[model samples]
Target chain A: MGVGPSTKETSLHHFRDPLVDIVGSDSGIDLMGVLVFGSPEGNEEKIRCSRTAAVVAECCRPDGVIVETDGWGNLDVDYVNCVNEIGERGIPVAGLNWSGTAGTFVVDSPYLDNVVDFNKNPEGIESNIVGENNYTADDVRECVKRLKIAMLKKGMNK
Target chain B: MGVQEIDLRRLVIKSFHMTDVQMGDENKITMDGKLTIDGSYVKDLAERHSKVIEKIDIQIIQPGDHDRYTNTIMDIIPISTKVLGKCGEGITHTVTGVYVMPTGVDVDGEQAHEFGSSEGNLKDMLYLNRAGTPSDTDIIISFDITFKKGMGQERHAIIEAYHAVDEWIQVYREQMKKFNGNKATEKHEYHDVIRPGQKKVLIIKEMIAHGAMLDTWIFPNEPSGVAGGKSLIDYGCMPVMLTPNEFRDGAIHSMN
Candidate 1:
């Protein structure tokens, strides 16, 4: 997972914090540690970080994993690669990104599915309003549900 | 910082809508939604920066006229002025439906500003109506500034270009101060409040202040205007804290 700048307004919640809270509060889900990483400066480093993060997540032995990114464009390269690394290990994975219209995924993979685009702008672009197009409580809930379904299909109960 | 039980401050922004813009003998916004720019003032502004600025061509780009060619866009500036109090907490008067775009190139035709110059048709080069771009209904005031030979790559010369445009916009800023609050097309109020029982959150913004074309400015006199701001490079790239209202009020003026 990735975290970027705070939204413009103070009253709204950042996507990462609320998502963590929701997962932590759930009795059925055993939440692992959050992995906060910076944007790698080079392509080789980005790939290295992706594989390393996937290995760490696999060591925790979670039934399902959700990878999210707050940005698009070149950052998508690492985001998709990280998800692919996890999926290649036979782990179920989903994604969360801002790809509703203007930022539609430039690259995709068979390992990537059930992506939630939390864009709220009517024009489907970055409206600049604080928390307008960010992940909400409802979006987070949907992502959790998808993860549960993926686990259930694999005969694993969270 | 911990939360306290007090309202930090409040800011009220009043906006006047402008539908059209044209070059004329005087600089003023009419009551009927037209903005006229005095050509002589622009000529004088160019002369004032003669050491760095060689020639300036001002064009009034109508809405939807993005097929025309332009130099690399240096900045997209909003015209706003402080009517009362300071920047974060005060009455601000601003103009809507128009934006100022400063484009630059050297006398040798080398693009200034970005590492990769986006000098092409405005339509192809810009993603309009985005967070940092002009809307589809905006009237653009394009300041095409050609710098002296080899001056485009100089940090000080580029700063002078931005300063010159800021000075030119001051003419309209003065006019904005006189706009009646009741005549404003839109009004918004923002406040900085502390919620005691709520969880605390801090957002970190990463900015580039490496000299020569990549820099960020903070706390200009006017919203998104380039005058009276401190460069991040000068601050040694230290981390700065700002209240949410301050960020929404345009405290960070990105020069890249």
Candidate 2:
């Protein structure tokens, strides 16, 4: 199958149905969505995407999003807007910008890790988001790990 | 009145074995055991009078073995006193009581080892030192009864004894708290920072017994390769130490 758009439409199509099933329609908590924005800089796209994802995830409710961006420095406006909306709702969002194909970025949450990656070109970006082409699974694991630590630290301080 | 002399009886020493292990690998070793006047005797003596056995003190003596020098540790095993009978003496109530031993006593291995000579046989003498050292020691339970035989009083002395024991336990608990250290009150800080481009690293920190911190890591990203440090003292995590106060307040707001 040909690769599809890594925009808000695609993430919604993939995640919204499952999230609805989990939270239920009348539960009053919506599973907000994630938006991945390509870095304006050439080499820093992965870092930008990761930083944005961390910030967005903190702003949103936990377990609300999976942001995917093609590593080739192209911004997805609609997805960005969805991230903003989720941010407004206080749901957390996380973004993965793959160096190669958008499908390659690792999708991770506190409870989930090493999700399905279908990208073909591993070398297309500075950092491969998942598997061998990227940093080891341990690195990806730390991203979520440190985020949780930060969250807990934030919780205890208050 | 001139001073009168009261003769004191020597408490008989009974044989006992170390039954419990407090720590380390080697388990139960037997030691020379001694018998003190069972605490129940005080209650029995007090029953003839119209008074209660408030407290009793016993001295422990070590009977030395001839073959080897033996050192023995002594522990006071408290026995529970259950209520037996209560009665009225004419117009007043008098309580009568009896005391019994609850369970066997415990002895320690060090005491047992001391009894073992170079020949590997246990020595005969149960040694008593000025220092209060305990062998395998255990608390014993005893009971008391307040009601006497001839009087009309009905409540047993054991009920009052139970109250006394309860008060004693409370006192012991307070003393233990003081000995263990002050209750932990202060908040602690934990920090971890990840630099860019490093991979295959993890950080872990936890609180261990006696409020010690344990930190460990796997595949650390730093070139120095060390991934662990602990807080100097016991502390709870707080917001200001972890995040800017404004950010923490905002985060709390978001969570709410």
Candidate 3:
């Protein structure tokens, strides 16, 4: 929540993209492109980013969607909006974040229930430890697990 | 006759791998994969930034030696230089198996330019062998800078520190330019290609240039270097168009 360095610099080098390994191991799951979004500067920018992300995910035409954000607080406004926008389009979207009890979304939708909190800290709070609450392979697997159920529910709804 | 397309710009990057690093009489790369650096030149390097910098300590941290406590990390810079031609269209010599990390703190024991300082044991604070970090086998050249008591928060203080490190590395860059390209440990060639009657693709990369530590350097004379590069803030954070070959050649130096 209170990182000194830019997220662009810290996030890229501090963690391995688990998506690479997951795609290599599972043939049924064809990995799509990754969409990146930073903390928008203003409310307009936030809404724009959320809509753009949803539009991009729609273009990908996947069976399910997993949206991950490396931030909390005000950033969750766009995070939850992105999920809701995709969900409103009938896409089964799941959110990945470091929701350490206190890291709740500022604006949320019904789709927020499918969120996977990847907090590894014992205290379930933001710490100075770099990469402590980052998304891992286990978290990605859990998101996939929940996403499959959401997709099944959507199929039943249709 | 149909006009044939030719690749006008080609970049060749020659890499040399150094397995071991040590402080010695002079800076030189041996045939046995050992990089010997002259520690005596650090005093002269510190002299370049005497106003804001108090002292500069140059040390080589070997692989798996991450238990040692250190100051806040500023940046991890790759050692690369242009051996022939310009940045994107010519020959570049680079060092693999090693990276230069800059760490800093003020005289009053405050971490420099960091809001949430990562000042604990290195292993516990950093993820090793990531895209921008040192690999498991790579040695780390730690350039620890000590700023003046009240200068840690100033943007120029960190810039001077980086300039000192750049000057120190220029010594090695000059020597690397003279190495034989045939003996390079790795070689990669890239071309800037253009195709007509095809869909256009553009990659929009967003960078932070909100002033202070949130700045980025673009189009340095050397690959991934600070010299001759313009800061994104200096450009008013405008959209700068760059070729793919230029980008792949290390055009963007993230100061953040």
* DockQ for all models: 0.05, 0.01, 0.12
Docking class of 2: incorrect
Q: Candidate 1 DockQ category?
A: incorrect
TM-scores (chain A) of the candidates: 0.86, 0.32, 0.86
Per-residue lDDT tens digits for candidate 2, residues B1-256, read: 3223221211111112222222222211122211223345444444443443323222222222224322221111221111111110001110011111111111211111111111111122211110111122321212222223321111123223323333332322232222211222221221122222222111111111111001111111111011121221212210011111111111110000
Worst 10 residues of 2 chain B by lDDT: B247-256
| Poorest lDDT segment (10 consecutive residues) of candidate 3 chain B | B196-205
TM-score of each: 0.65, 0.18, 0.68
Show model 3 residue runs off by greater than 4 Å.
A1-158, B1-8, B30-32, B194-200
What lDDT tens digits, residue by residue, belong to model 3 across residues B111-224? 875445666788777666555567778888989889898777788877777778888878888888888888889997866654332212222233444344555677777777
* lDDT pick, better of 2 and 3: 3
TM-score of 3: 0.68
**Evaluated with TM-score, which candidate comes out highest?**
3
Question: What tens-digit string does per-residue lDDT give for candidate 3 at A51-154?
Answer: 67677767756667777655566667767777888889888876677677667666768888878887766877665454466566787678767776787787
Give the per-residue Cα lDDT of candidate 1 at B246: 56
Off by over 4 Å in 2: A1-66, A69-75, A99-136, B1-256
With a 3 Å backbone cut-off (N, CA, C), the pairs that clash in candidate 3 are: none
